[model samples]
Target: MAGAAIKKKIGLFFGSFNPVHVGHMIIANYMATQTDLDQVWLVVSPQNPLKPKNSLARDYDRLHLVRLAIGENPNLRASDIEFSLPKPSYTIDTLTYLKEKYPDHQFVLIMGGDNLASLHRWKNYELLLRDHEIFVYRRPGYDIPQHFEEHPQVHFFEAPLMHISASYIRQAIQEGHSVQYLVTEPVFQYLESSALYKS
Candidate 1:
């Protein structure tokens, strides 16, 4: 089975992209281009259906923002896999579903340093560490244990990350400030034309 079929290397980037921004695009593009990955999927974290409605359809809204942020980049893609999965999604569970769904694709987990630090606390984390390759991006001020770094499945990249946070962008939008450069042109245009986070 070694050379029976060439598997597609897909990087799974999970996030709650309340509003996808330029930073996410940059990192995703970098990972796709700089690494051996054929495509980098920005997987949107689904909103809990059981929770009370906040009047904002965050599940679909975030997916659209991610799509807008990615634009026509061939190497980058926006995925709403979690939106259809069980609520309170887990990395291992998502990985399992994706693996079963796409048998020819090898899914790699892409995460920030902050997530890496707390990965052990996640549900079925041992399975995640054992079954999938973990790609950690550069993040300031977040630290990880040396033992995990020594793990063969865990790899780190020096991709530069913007200090800007989604909360900051939301706050800026609420204040009626221009976030033209903070996000992609399409996202910025959409936000400008629509009342997204100004509540």
Candidate 2:
């Protein structure tokens, strides 16, 4: 059998992105420019197996918000591949599908230190680390394990500390608070006009 074709390194940033915001974009942009990654794809998950289903907005709405957030950044992209897949999206399943569909593209996982600390609970977590590199950005206070330092595929990046989270944004919006400047103007408008995040 022939080996898969090689293409530019693409960073896979998986998230609920219930409503895409500036913090999300900043991490992506920083990764693209600071790391070896050539492009960053915001993989908007329909549902996360570990998170509450009720936490998410409609899959399409989230995807649309991601699209709006990226705007014309040629290196940034939004993908809704998880929506068409089975429910309770798992990182392993999504990564497997992406590898098959975009064989030419080399993929690296982008996550925060908090996620890394809990990655052992993920389905097929071992295979994920073995098959692809991980770019971990720092979170508020989560400590990365010492073993990760021994792994060749694990990389740590010190991105600006925004302390921003999707849940906080959602809470603020639901309470009729302004989300201005935290997200791009278009995404903020979409969230309000579409009445997303309302309890």
Candidate 3:
């Protein structure tokens, strides 16, 4: 008899994850449970073209933080695929590579309303919209743009939005404030142990 076929719908959540925080995990968990996605992969970007290079932590450190945040969640994973790819990683390229590598799995792009607003600025933005499905979670103040409000490939979810941000956490650490509930305990411990974000 033939082995069971490989068929899993994976949601790709791409971010720098300067230090993976609870907000990131909450959004991913919601997507995994509320949507048809079978799993969620937090694809850590080595360098986002739009972001400043100096604002990010080391690639491996960010990857490690993502892994630590995911912990034993069977349906959640951390990927360093972008690290091996070209610098200033682009979403379209990452999606294409993932599709080619995991032929049996359906990959959906997971992003926030803020990203949707700036989607047009992305490389091959039109191709990305036409080629893959995107799950956009609502952010605090950003609204879904009119152009993408009715897009066939775009789906919006009411995942809980947290005001917390990686930069905020880093600032707190640098200012000697408590970041207790902002990030996962393991990640917090790792950051402290490594003396990260401390200038």
Candidate 4:
């Protein structure tokens, strides 16, 4: 008898990745190296429904930054799947498209504890938890609630946490301050030459 095929596990780490900081790279690398996932796709979301759109950098610029940050790592990838999707891309819709587009791969939702806490507010939030593997990383001051226990598919990891935020980086750059180590060298150089975040 032939053994059943093992589906390739891909963790979808969705984010704005405003400048693709070192903190984002750290989490993505940790997840890919430590987890059962074969690859981790850093999905650069064009627009998040819950987040304010006014602050986001250009879609292609963010995507390019993510790609530059990832470089040639086989386990990590940059994705612009949401660019062609509708405005304010919904998680469920993106998952559905991926499922249909690539049937041989298993997709997992990579998120922070803060995102898990606000799951109730997402579009089709129940269906998202019901059908997909949700991998959550811990964040400072945000803890996953005990009341919502769905153990089997929802997994948690204590990946290294950093207090750095994209907003803080943006604010710093806007104020003519240095953001040298926050982002990768390529990203830093790119930011140095362009006025992407400067108001």
lDDT of 2 by residue, 73-148 (tens): 8989999888888888898898899889987889999999999999999999999999999999988778889999
Off by over 4 Å in 3: 1-6
Which candidate leads in TM-score? Answer: 4
List candidate 2 stretches off by more than 4 Å: 1-6
Tell me which of candidates 1 and 3 scores higher on lDDT. Answer: 3
Give per-residue CA lDDT, model 3, range 20-114, as digits (tens).
89999999999998999999999999999998999888899889899989899998999999988987799999888888998998888999999
Judge candidate 4 against the unseen true structure and give its global Cα lDDT, from 0 to 1.
0.92
In model 3, the Cα lDDT at residue 19 comes to: 79
Error of 3 at 118 (Å): 0.6
What is candidate 4's lDDT per residue for 1-199, written digit by digit as tens? 9997899999999999987899999999999999999999999999999889988999999999999898889999999998988888999999999999999999999999899999999999989988998999988798678854556778989999778999999999999999999999888988999988988
TM-score of each: 0.93, 0.93, 0.94, 0.96
Show pairs that collide, candidate 4. none
Q: Distance (Å) between predicted and true CA of 96, model 1? A: 0.8
Clashes counted in candidate 2 amount to 0
- Judged by TM-score relative to the true structure, which candidate is superior, 3 or 4? 4
